[model samples]
Target chain A: MSDARTALYDDHLAFGARMVPFGGFEMPVSYAGILREHDAVRHRAGLFDLSHMAQYHLEGPGVGHWADALTVNDVATMKPGQARYNIFTNDAGGCHDDVLFYRLDENRWLLVVNAGNAAKMWPYLVARADGRRDVKITSGHGSRALVAVQGPLATEIVAQLVDADITVMKYYTCVETHVCGVPAIVARTGYTGEDGFEIFVDSDAASELWRNLFERGSRFGLEPAGLGARDVLRLEAGMPLYGHELDESISPVAGGQRWAVKTRKAAFRGRDAIVAELEADTHDRIAGIVLDGRVPARDGYAVYVGDERVGTVRSGSMAPSVENKNIATVLVTKAASVLGGSLDVEIRGTRHRATVVALPFYKRPTP
Target chain B: MAQPAGLLYSKEHEWLKVEGDTATVGITDYAQNSLGDIVFVELPRIGAALKQHANIGVVESVKAVSDLFTPAGGEVVEVNAALEADPALVNRDAFGDGWLYKIKIDASSMPDALLGPDDYEKLVATS
Candidate 1:
């Protein structure tokens, strides 16, 4: 394994987890099993050691306008303590990375980026950040750690473990408070589609907070989930991954994230190209396909629109939590991107029928 | 978990139980453990001739798709039909009702060799 150790390396080792190199970090792949951990998140709650994701804090007199220009989403109207799901694109209009921009204060904000692209994204942001805009980029990947606690009853589970009113913070809002007397940033945001909170804290105190929270929340059926469960949960939730569902060659509008890309604005990195491509309605698209059987079509499996080679499956898995069927997100045609469109994937040598469905296979029930 | 005695194992983590010239084949406990949860299994058709290490079947779990290899060169006689509706049986009782197929051995000792419990155990430990 070429990846380095995170701050919670010892904690994962203590839990008897299988660690593997992911994006240059020795991350836990699974503790018990992928299905068991997936079940833990579906039935009750699961805690994830998300300490590997990169964090950047930006605050200044002109943070909103500066940050809004950097990302595709219009963040100028966002209030303090609110967060937006956004993405950054390269000069070719290809997605640089998908991230969440957290507005911590009037001038302070936190941008959580994908782990593998952090080193690439950080320097890109630094070079892109015009000092005249009065924006300062503070890299916190080494200083901060994060955990995602998610499930149907995630709010009550977190409520029992935290002293702050995290339950009423509303979705996409975060509040800084203490958990077991450790200062933490509790944000009501998650990729699991389930109601959940993400806790961001300093590196020195992260392990202790993870241990205490895992112990206190265990009674609520919380399992210390790893990357395996995280993949399944987020895939079920229909969230886009950095390398799988997107990359430098893929367009963000293809993933139903065109809302995040503001066209009326003056210009960002990929503004001109994206605006032109939107007008032309180019060649690629991202579609959700639910398989007929349980065999998960792998990453590179070819997709055929009735014998015609249309596209390829990107991320796929047997969605045991939803059904025994294999669910996948594939890149297909703009003309054939409509929901209920029938498609087939070549699983080994046979083509299996699959239907394009709406995202987030399972939605958390409101309490 | 200890490898169940009397079950002939394959290097690919499949187990075989011999009864006269007819042998039952299924994925071993190690295979199930590595695959996480078994959701589906695609079995070989009856009377299909298979050589040792041939891809006669495929096991689908939550994480991956693994090909089921044959232990010996033989003709597939019967497939465990229970897998179509309930493939999870492979994970629940891999050595018992979870057996995938039965093949008629071509010779006295069959065409190829199967790994013993000790050999299989070492293979899993290292893997």
Candidate 2:
């Protein structure tokens, strides 16, 4: 099947973005350049078009209770205007998707899932919601557009177009407000690990919102970034990518997200399996690795300790923020994931020395 | 786009500048642009013998890696040392400072398959 295009397709073309097929959609992989755009988001501000992700709207008094039973996090306890990270798991404790829940109001909530998982998640939700009249699930995949501005200067850029005093909004909070003269859901949340805002607006308003933000943000050195840079940024920040870090076959505990698993809850999907894995504590887990050389470790590269093969690289990149060295996440044996452990990544039949380090190879400076 | 004049080109997007018996080899502008944000370049060792159109090295960008081929065969005289410290030189100046290596080869020894600037431009246009 042909790939679908987002509302900002024309705008991306005009900006000279390099488009690639991702998650069944035609999306930009880079604009000016991957490294250039990455640097912009680190020191200045960078804008992104994330409309490919699927946003599902849940409403009615049963929404919270319904979501709480499906996800690992406590959706029922989330206050209005708060955003929480969650994971849906199968009976085997494998993750279906890692998503974010935005509580817009007491009875209204937005669940954002990965673009690649939209097809699976939509059907899964529909089948589960059958015969439940009090709960409703609506798909906003193509009708809504998501634009994110991320960096140290992101606040200055977003505050200009937003009608509300977004400066007062804390991290992981959302508010319904007007931006660029159109209705939008402004959230102080991002995947880049930078201080940023994600704006959700109608499809028709995406072009104006992107153009206005670009024009005004130019003075603050805002450049258009694409998925290539976004991948590098998120990796450096230690944020998990759905396909790489979390997948249908990988449990959250093994994906280095044990904190998100609230097994103490009365009941939830995969609760028994998750609790069993937690108690076992023998499963291979995700761990960070920094190569000792310049050659990049790519996904699926073999990782070894001496002669024994331990794991494969789940995600890898040349991280500019982490001393401009190569960083990667490997799903490795429990013994091999110990901090400061010595490991080698075999690239093209050559073993390069590496160190098992902590997650978050780079962290933003606190002001 | 038209290729730089006075250079022989390969179908693999390598450009060759012959100066007497020594030829300087580098990737074409089209090749560099397509690779995007080169982070590392693995050039063949100096003094190594290579065949025409032989896979000599590798050029890696942020997202992918591409093989580097030589347009002509010769003894490797020198490799660009600047690339070791800064591989993005290829992205900035593919035909200038980004030249990969030097080979001791006669101009007449170059394979007949090597295209001239006009022919290379045509190849790029159709690509």
Number of the top-ranking candidate, with lDDT as the measure? 2
Q: Each candidate's DockQ score against the native complex?
A: 0.71, 0.85
User: Among these predicted structures, which one has the highest TM-score?
Assistant: 2
Residue-level lDDT of model 1, residues A1-367, one tens digit each, is: 4687778899999988889888778999899888888888888989888888999988787777876676677777788889889888888888889999888888888899999998898998888675656788889996899988888768877786677888678899988788778888889998777788999989888888888878877888898889988898888888888888888888688766787787877777688778888899966788888998666788899999876888999999877666656889999887556799889899879989899898767666666
Total clashing pairs in model 2: 0
Model 1 spans > 4 angstroms off: A130-133, B108-113
**Deviation from native of the Cα of residue A53 in model 1, angstroms:** 0.8
Interface DockQ of candidate 2? 0.85
Can you tell me the DockQ of model 1? 0.71
Candidate 1 CA-lDDT value: 0.83
Which candidate has the highest DockQ of all? Answer: 2
lDDT of candidates 1 onward, in order: 0.83, 0.93
Where does model 2 sit among the CAPRI classes? high
Chain A TM-scores for all candidates read: 0.95, 0.99
